[model samples]
Target: MTTASPRWFKSSYSGTTSNCVEVAINLVASHGTVPVRDSKVSDGPSFSVSASAFSSFVAGVKGGRLGV
Candidate 1:
């Protein structure tokens, strides 16, 4: 088994806002989930969503269906 960990990153589109979220997709292939966390809170709690669900959410955002 592979020993993997989240590799978090924030979008460049986030600009300089302190209110941002980071996501780690590195584990998705093995874990089947995407981990997300607040950029301001590195040690804070993070949550995971199914890869399919995360993909849908991204699509919605890209299509402007999520109001950005």
Candidate 2:
């Protein structure tokens, strides 16, 4: 997939620093996995995930379910 098509989004929580990460969402023909990448490296590597896995991740994050 072309890097141009992925829409990168920044977290609402950010600090006053030059260093920050961005998430790119690429929902294409791959129906299950959600592609995520760093904004600094648009052409860099990315991680893939199933839709259910992604949801669980978000839920854990919001609910502090990770036990971190």
Candidate 3:
């Protein structure tokens, strides 16, 4: 089967810096997971996390629980 590619984007909170990761929100609905990768490494390895887990991680970051 042909797989769909994840559309990755950096977080809005990320300023002009290389220390940032890109996340593909599109995959959450179709794949039930979120693909993540380093913004500086476009051709590098990527990893996926469950949608719920990714959501929790984002919530923690927004709530300062992740200490981001």
All models: lDDT? 0.94, 0.65, 0.89
Which pairs in model 2 have colliding backbones?
none
Query: What C-alpha lDDT does candidate 3 achieve relative to the native structure?
Result: 0.89
Q: What root-mean-square deviation over C-alphas does model 2 reach?
A: 3.5
Which model, 2 or 3, shows the larger lDDT?
3
Give the best candidate by lDDT. Answer: 1
List residue ranges in candidate 3 displaced over 4 A.
Answer: none
Please write out the lDDT profile of model 3 over residues 28-58, one tens digit for every residue. 7788999999999989999999999998997
Off by over 4 Å in 2: 1-4, 15-21, 25-30
lDDT of 2 at 11: 73
The residue-by-residue lDDT of candidate 2 on 1-68, one tens digit each, is 33345566667776554355655455634455566766567677877777678778989999998989
Model 2 global lDDT (CA atoms, 0 to 1) = 0.65
- Which ten contiguous residues of candidate 2 have the minimum total lDDT? 23-32
TM-score of each: 0.91, 0.64, 0.87
Name every residue pair that clashes in candidate 1: none
- The model with the greater TM-score, 1 or 3, is 1
